[model samples]
Target: MTGFVIRQLGPADAAAYREIRLEGLERHPEAFGSTYEAEAALSPEEFVRRVVEVPTFAAERDGRLLGLVGLARESGVKRRHRGTLIRMYVRPEARGSGAADALVEAVLDHARSEGLDAVLLAVITEAEPARRLYERHGFKVYGVEPGALRIGDRAYDDELRIRFL
Candidate 1:
């Protein structure tokens, strides 16, 4: 994790986002709301627009992308103070390392800079390690949606976690 560059992603870095996203979806199919197949069909322009428009950060080492996280501010005037955390993925080799922590911190820093009051995320209940990571980051599990995601006939509960910035 040391010597890795964690920085705000720009238009040129859309490919990094796409690559890590594909890697994530392929490795963890039931871990996200989107599918790898659908997301893989997106045009480069669309990918660039989405990544550059939102607050996304990436970890790189030796000029190779290692991980990434995305933070999307809530829309509508009433929800201006809220943000959503999504698309957090670290290469398996980087797990238990500090790469994911750095990416999460970068997202939180971006939330604070954007004047957001809080950030929210949903973790599948069965993902114990991920739940612990969120807890360590000051996120509290406030609620759960039973059978939130149905992947290949299997139901998974979603645990909602939030933190005030």
Candidate 2:
């Protein structure tokens, strides 16, 4: 936790990123929009493409990845000023080690560098810890998206939040 490094993930980090990504999806299915099965089926090249296409930041300590977060900029003419934070996850053992906070900060810093006026993200309504994390980083809830994600027979609502840079 003391010497963790936060940096942008590149092609060489695809494998580590994929591993932690799948772990997050599998362990907390309700916390993510993508399913484990879907991501698990993706080819190695696809994971490489993902890290290249999306601006992803990873937290690493002693050569091991601890967490990651991605910032996807909007492409539309009107929405180009905004970016969405996605695929945020920190390894279970890395929680409370400042990895999550560092990841979120990296995303925001990248958003600013890209000239984004705002950054948006949606957290599961029941995930109070995640919600609090966002709030502590200057994000404020603007609305609640009812039943944003559905896993099997259960439905999960999402809290929509935004931070203006």
Candidate of highest lDDT: 2
Clashes of each: 0, 0
Once fitted onto the true fold, the runs of candidate 1 whose alpha carbons sit more than 4 angstroms away are none
lDDT of 2 by residue, 1-165 (tens): 568999999999899999999999999999999999999999999999999999999999988999999999999999999999999998888899999999999999999999999999999989988998999999999999998999888999999999999
lDDT of 2: 0.94
Cα lDDT of model 1 by residue, 1-165, tens digit: 478889888888888778888999989877899999999998989889988788888888887788888999888999989998998888987787788888889999999988999999998999988888899999998999999889888999999999998
Cα lDDT listed for each candidate: 0.88, 0.94
Clashes of 2: 0
TM-score of 1: 0.96
